[model samples]
Target: MGRSDVRPSRSSPLAWGVLGLWLLVVVLALPLAGQLGESTEDEGVDYLPASAESTEVARLTELLPGGDTTDLLLVAQRPGGLTAEDRALVERRLERIDALFDVAAGDPAAAGVVSGDGGTALHPFSLGELGEEEQGQAVGEIRELIADPPQGLTLALGGPGALGVDAEAVFESIDVTLMLATAGIVAVLLVLTYRSPLLWLLPLFAVGVAAVAAMALVNGLVSWFDLTVTTMSSSIMTVLIFGAGTDYALLLVARYREELRRLPGAGEAMAAALRGCGPALLASSGTVSLGLLCLTFADLNSSSGLGPVGAVGVLCALAVMVTLLPALLVLLGRRVFWPLVPRHGESRATGRDTFFARLGSSISRRPVTVLVGGTLLLGALALGTFRLPGPLAEQDNFTETPASVRAMELVADAFPERSGQPIAVLADADHAQEVREAALATDGVAEAEAGREGGGWREIQVFATDPPESEGEQATVDALRERLAELPEAKALVGGPTAQTMDLADTASHDQRLVIPLVLTVVLLVLAVLLRALVAPLLLLAAVVASWGAAMGLGGLVFGPVLGFEGLDAQVPLLSFVFCVALGVDYGIFLMHRMREEALNGADTRTAALDALRTTGGVIASAGVVLAATFCVLAGMPMVVMAEMGFVVAVGVLLDTFLVRTYLVTSASWLLGRRVWWPGPLGRRPAAPGQRAAVDAVPAGAGPRGDAG
Candidate 1:
């Protein structure tokens, strides 16, 4: 099967035309990224549930006096404790920060900057009605002023202002750092898988095109619609485009390579390749997209926004991989396969009867043992959830300790036992005096002061005896809210850092309860419809859910003890579940779709499972590695939440790839035999005319896709 069987590709200039048009589109849309950067929202309101109490408080506060208040903490500390000189240094820096901020915000000093216990200072800068850029510049200037303090006195910024600014800085870095990291990873994996220098670049180039297109599309949506773009969602979208796009590319390229062996011409081979695998790729992408869109019902706006953004990424990646990628391969002809290029009728290395072949045979030998053992292992790992970290605090958000976190630490030490942070209370101006008195009289209140009053509302700053986001402080807030509720005329709202954190944490919990079941239901329904077998879909979802639980259990053991996380980010479990289940179902589809194809073509159930594993082992494993590595790239990020999410997804993908898809699902398919495909005609029908028996008794764990790369 050499050149004798290889026919020349047709002179189809249309492929080149497609490439040219997409390139032109990319050129026109690339400039929108700059505008998108300015639009990357990381504000408190951006993350909260639309109708949550905290969201209302944030809104009401904006309506008061100047649009919004920029709370900033100026920390000054000395190792031995604060000295007179330290206090004076803090005062001077606060004055400088205030002046710079006032200039940027076009407002005079309103809330005075005062030191706490003479060790550090609280310079809560409340500004109104500034553009996002102006606010960023003001925060930047403030950060710079505190950049270097007087000798022996260290100054660091904290509060909502500092957190928002820092978050935006990380998001801005994604353009360069996260993208480069993802590309580097994909390149290495592709090189190892394809073993060709030039071959790897084609799929990578397609991913880049998809990424740009998706970003521009997202920017347009954000610019014109309710689609919100935050640092978290934007990052997740980038990962989806590269990771999932590459997954689709792997499947298409694998099929195209197979077609190249049998078909005469490259153009004809690509057409056949798309004909064979196009539905599976589109189905997988659709499954992921639908699962993500189900998040729209989520009460958490930030999480819900990711639904559409992620769906956009998958759809865009699908468009490029299916169209642009196939066009490129057709244009390049056999050269895309490089040194290992497939000649006609050579069967393209087949890579069957490898480690996975052996694994499938092993499962066939003792199906029940493998199934029970795998389930027990996963269940045991689930026990680690007992050791999982507690609720994440703002100070613990960073992978590396930032100055703000350090500043909070200093305040905690110097003002030991004082409400490490302030509690903000908003009440009607008519009942303002009463609210202030009530707050001061509260048992946890260390001090209370009246804040800016406007728009028929007044704010009161209540410094509690407990630290920020701590349970004790939570109790104080609850009490304050309850007391305020008694005065209906006050229309008091409890907000600020602590309140926002409480709301976010509670929302995450609620979203978990609501979104998880919906996500599972969505994925399962898609699988059932696609496979036409209720039992098979249930098995696939069960494996995915098990994988998620195992991944999180592993995360519980690793995050706090190994990664040094104090607690799992409230959002990690939900995000991880969404990713693991949605994408995990992908592997199941890859296997079952092929098995069903084989079964429908008249192969027996056992032969079909082995053949599916035999043929798909390489592509599935390669796809898994690409997706896992792309996610693992997030582990290097400075944010603890992103790191945890990355770890869990990486672990889950690998587990689903090597263990569940390869072993558990395959064994289940064999044990259930025809019953695995229950209610489907494929389950009841006999072999088709050309279908053959299982490949000659391959040893266990020897499928071609078993490289574990």
Candidate 2:
């Protein structure tokens, strides 16, 4: 791992070519910026439920008496009581809105309009189901029509269409917040890590190039394959780019510092740093990319989209880290660390047998004490797992927001049956009557509307008496679905607010059942190949699982009792499992790799474990701090899911870097002695002269307390 064996000269033409290609890709992707821009139009039609189940109901309704129609609920209020002028003005505006979308069948005044509570009026605009783009356009036209609205009349539009517009606006704000927060965190963390103005800028610049290039590449791929990017893609990019970029940057700079200590000149040090850290960076990036690729297995479109986009960002960051970062370092040389210089003729201290040195020694002396204490602490946290709750409904997703909370309150008061409940049932042409009859007979059905079609296929809409996410509501829907299934005429697909919640719950359950084992297997294979030892990966996997369970337990405590939320987000466990397992293995890899390297060089088991921690501990700690801070910013988002995710990831990374990798791995290696690498060739005594000499000087069972010479 030393600089002298693998250093690449700064003046090499190969390095410049790599840098040039990196710049070329970035420049090429700039043209696709328009494709990445989010839609800003607010449309009333976009707020309606457009799921497969909803669409079937709408299709069937088209054949009914009045025909299938979508209603736009226009709510208008005034400061005082309703006046003649206020009513007149609202009537005029409603007429205008109806005209904007050709709402009237023949006469313009035919559009349905109702005045409610004397002070407020509800204007219902009838439009059939509209596509997303069409709905966005319609909403924009409606907004423009009311732009110069009359005095004493304040208007707010709601329904399915309005919800869409509000969701888009909220999502946009979240995007901007996450981006700014991530950038601020990365900047501060890098500055603290390097304490050099120039070095601090390098990661930002590299990641910037990587991000731009990755997005452009993703855009091109999406266009070519006809893949749609979700509203959440930008947020995913923010996390992946910053997280991977920081990881890569840390590996490079840590190596750079080590090289500077070893080499006599800056050019040599820069070259050595790149060459030494290059393979490790590539290996790590590959693993992360592979881990993200696993997201393709997800049944949900949102999660699947994240897989490739996240993988692209990681791959791009790796390219920049290895090529552009190294070239820039070469060009800057010692000036990259201008204020901090290496003292001439100073030998870098391995720092083995320090405080952690004595700690590891003590743990090795009493392996049972260390193991028992760690297990008890983790197990205590695991007890909270039983209290974990299921996935929340769409309304519950925004339950923390003031507007949503207020809206829920109003619905509960005025329209309890309609409070956050929308259900749709679909059946084939022959079974429509039976299905509709069964649906109407179902208990807790507040209202059941039959479809227009007289043929076998008929769509039914059922409004439930309870909120969609409630257990009673779900049980009612499940019963209705089962009874409908028994009807001879229809083949039913049940979906709507309650159905979507159930679908998400099923998806999360399926993902956990499949993904956890898959990820663990992949990680084990990776560790096996990297360490060439079976016991190490097994122990490492155990520690990672323990950490994940502990994080879940802690999250349950926070969200369940402390925050007093119904339950933790359904996706929290999945997120914790993936991130904690994948990222936790990173620390394991860093530790075990260094330990193996030392052991191969002939150090005794105890000395090799201690020395490996001494060398890799600082970088691991710095990396954990940066990653933890970056994840912590998610707490500021409006959504409860984001807040819970942020907290868990932050805590998980801290435990992984500090507690597990530093103390646990080192102590386990020391206690296991030579058997740590058992059933592997490395477990056997080294045949090399250097290894024999190092091992003989440090004997096993030499009383874990010793001085570093």
Candidate 3:
């Protein structure tokens, strides 16, 4: 239990080679990593459900005359009423807008309209087909052109086009901001955990190398395989590399430090450390990578794209942590630990294992009480889900209200009966008239009109009687789809901003149902194989799942009442669950694997459990804190989706680490004893007196000694 048996000095040449190879990879990765942001796309088609009606419409819309068009509403208002000067200023601004930008050919508001309340004037226009980049530029220019309105006249730009511009701004800045913030968080945590300024730099540097390499590789995937990379996916990838990479470093380094006490040389000690903890590292990485890859089955394009992007990150972190990190550490030798370096033949009974040993003893004294208490606590926390808010609306996606959202509010106040964004219905040109008539006849339709025709398809712009994303608006969209479906050969598709949001939300729900089970199954099978037991994997799986529920419930409690967020994003639940199950299971693997090793070495069940907890607990706790803090970096992001995801996953990791893995799993193991490994060789009681016993069937350390409690 004190130290691993050291092998010959075999790591010198391998370490040097790994170091050399990593230096080269890092050099090549720098520029490519910088270019990764350029490849990310935040377009509607990039995030919409692949097979949804909204996605198809988005695709076909690009085939129209001006590429994909953007619509905008220019609003000018005064609280009391619009005066003559206000109208004149608005008129001049409208003329300037028309002259500067290529307005769509046919617009109802080519000339501005005054509201009946006499306090507002609205002008609606669409930019002629422009690329995504060009669209953002156009919106920016328009905002600048109409920067400050005359006194008493409030001029604001509002529409889907303006909203996209605002969102793209956030997306553009996310990469640099996220990387810096995540690095800072990890650096701080590592320094605190290691209590060594010098040692912290090595893991942080190695993780940074992994991040750059992952980014370069991900960008290559985008270019070659047409993988979708969104700002959120790319940001999460950076977090995964840093978080998972640092966790691996902590586990490996802790084991190496332990080996250092018994082994004479650093090279020999590192080899033993790698031998001891390598399986857990590989299993941990594999579980996370495969769990994320399950996102490929998600209907949402963003969710599916994140699968490979995140998997690539975890794999890159694994590669670098095992090879580059170990190589660097081995070459640096024991002094790299500085101030508190481990020496040969040092005492094994340091304070490191004492706390966890005492904890294990306490839990073992009343295992059933501990187990039942933990379960009830998790269940009570899970009830917080009932307090969760509704699905986030488009205008509420940002943590702070951008100008576009402000404009939307202003427009909504003035134009209660009209929606600034219209629902688009695409149909066969042959049946355009019939589809339009049917749409007009639909219960929620206020008006329907023919739009551009291209590529054997005709676009019909349908205005709903209700505002966008409202219950009434969604109902209208549903009614239109149903009404249009009955038309003979119409092949009509209902889509628009509202429809796209609906599709994304529905797809998220479907993805949660699909991906959660896939992630659980993948993680369970992995645990079963690793532990070589049925009962243990099931126990760990249930622990992480329950931990997820508790974390999400905590999120529900925090997101609304504490954070003041309006509602949860559609993607948060699925993404958080994936990370929680995958990453949370990591600590369970570490603790259980060590316990199994002890049992295999012929230690009694009680002693093995306590010893595993004693030896691995500190490092596991440090890894958990690092992972949790890294994820908490997401809370700094402006996007609600990322913020919520970061909060839930971070909470779940902490709960799994400090609560379930530390107490619940240990207590359960003590109670189950050999049954914890049921159906496996280790699970069986000693053979009958006459029969030969299995290799691990001896009762040398089988009894639960009272002092172990």
Candidate 4:
């Protein structure tokens, strides 16, 4: 199709109108964006499946007299046995600790338990119905209350409450930290990629607007749809906005530059650019959004919530980039390109002279060799999955060993026969005694006793003989659950910190089984519809899946050996798969779409593959680096899950960008020739000198076309 068919008028007023509209959106969204943090919750319950046993216990607890309690452990330990003086010091500290809880809504405090070894004492405290902030402050006061432990005696706070405090401390400033870090990374990468001081600012500014808008939308989702947003989801959303928005900006700007060399004015150039790349952008965002939406099928609350949260970020980025970015670029004119500006009628280097073009030529000469080598490399990397450790334990969740974790370690070592973490049994009040009796009879049970009775339920505090989160403890919990299951009248539900972790891991596995196939299907259908061919979409999907495997393999090697992570989080594999497959397919779409466009426009299979790579290669590289770097920011987070997630997605994106899209996909397409477009017109028709496909010359990819400046 002719350029005139798709181009808007050079002097259109839409650019100014679009700019004005986006400014209004920013003004309206800023306040709501601030409230987003207010809606974010990071409790264990928040991550649990709504229908899980642990979730029901958590829910039932909140309905009791004191709502939810902040349970903490005060540990006093020494290498040598406690002397009379040390015992008296522990007694005095216990009094002070009791006073701390006594002031908080007058909740009753339990007596301290001295280990048989006489070297350690564990005192459990509860602050009833405290808000998150109040809980943190209360934990702090307790720490201060026992700050002066006698020289050899080590005093530390452990238990769920202390752990929450440490975790919350890491997440408290997550949003601001993530935004600043992501923006800084994108800015640096953008400057390096574009090599123009002025050019970097436009995309950066546009992406910032997108992030603000996305946060506001997310906050609204929280209020309206009751969407769950955790620090992990929100942080990932922020990274997605900056990374994806910048990527879109890069692609559009590259296309606009190419158009500028041929078109008469900025408006027409941008209109033509948008017209060319618009479908691919829409298709790319659609694939990502739909793929994320597949997470809604997950049973885990955090995983399900992340689907919509991330989709919101991607959609907002797309809207701003397609509208606000274009308006800004058109309004600024060719001057934004500065120094490397494309002047009308200027002749420049063609694809034949470009690095990607040369690389494509070499691959085309020996397509099978490149394809086999690339596949073998990807397969080898995938073998690293065998090296991946088991589910991440609670103590291993943090990148650094917080005080709580250290305390837990001491308590575990001191009281080797007893579990510090309680296994809560929520049983029918009518049959509470029977459930308690059964729990005590379980194989791993060290102790089981009836506790709080309210809201038609009775709490049974059960302690396993094994340490918390140990394989043996998990087995005991399973045995107790089975015993309770037989007592139909009891309707007992086992929950607590350990139970929650088990449920999360189980649910994560279930989610993987359910969501993975759905995501692949959604992505496959999108590719099929977009490309209008079965074989091409299948090939793209295979390449994407292989890339994901390679990325996960790299994580297996890096996470434990290089980063000292204890083990992979239960959720990482599924989340990473969704991200790598969904987001990684983006580069594939840009390449394959452009290649099909070239094919329909009279280029043979070889020329189409080479030109597509040559045109899209530079911008895809820039976008990939920017995105990878943006996610790499998560590595600095104190949370192991976030760091692992960041590493996998970033690696997957880099692999997809530099290797899969550039070589494997290109070589495969070249070898397949027109057969890649099987069941489509291109599959049947031989290359004719003057014939163009019925479809318009749909432009995609983010690199300069040959010999046009």
Off by over 4 Å in 4: 1-12, 100-111, 689-709
- The predictions' CA RMSDs to the true structure, in order, are 4.2, 5.6, 4.2, 5.2
Q: Give one digit per residue, the lDDT tens place, for model 3 in 280-362.
A: 99999999999999999998999999999999999999999889988888877877887777878878774524888778767
Q: Please estimate how well model 1 matches the true structure, expressed as its whole-model Cα lDDT.
A: 0.80
Q: List ranges where model 1 is wrong by over 4 Å.
A: 1-8, 67-69, 79-81, 87-152, 348-353, 441-443, 686-709
Quick one: how many clashes does candidate 1 have?
17
Residues 57-129, candidate 2: write the lDDT tens digits. 5445445543534445555556455577766766677677766674522232333333334454445455555
Using lDDT as the measure, name the better of candidate 2 and candidate 4: 4
Model 1 quality (TM-score): 0.92
Let me know the TM-score candidate 3 reaches against the reference structure. Answer: 0.94
Model 4 C-alpha lDDT per residue in residues 54-128, reported as the tens digit of each score: 899888876766556787777888877777777677677767766656433322233367788778877776676
Worst 10 residues of 3 by lDDT: 691-700
User: Can you tell me which runs of candidate 2 are displaced by over 4 Å?
Assistant: 1-10, 37-71, 74-156, 265-271, 343-345, 352-367, 399-405, 417-420, 451-457, 560-567, 686-709
Better of 1 and 3 by TM-score: 3
Please, what are the lDDT tens digits per residue for candidate 1 over residues 87-108?
6666676666655555333222
TM-score of each prediction: 0.92, 0.84, 0.94, 0.94
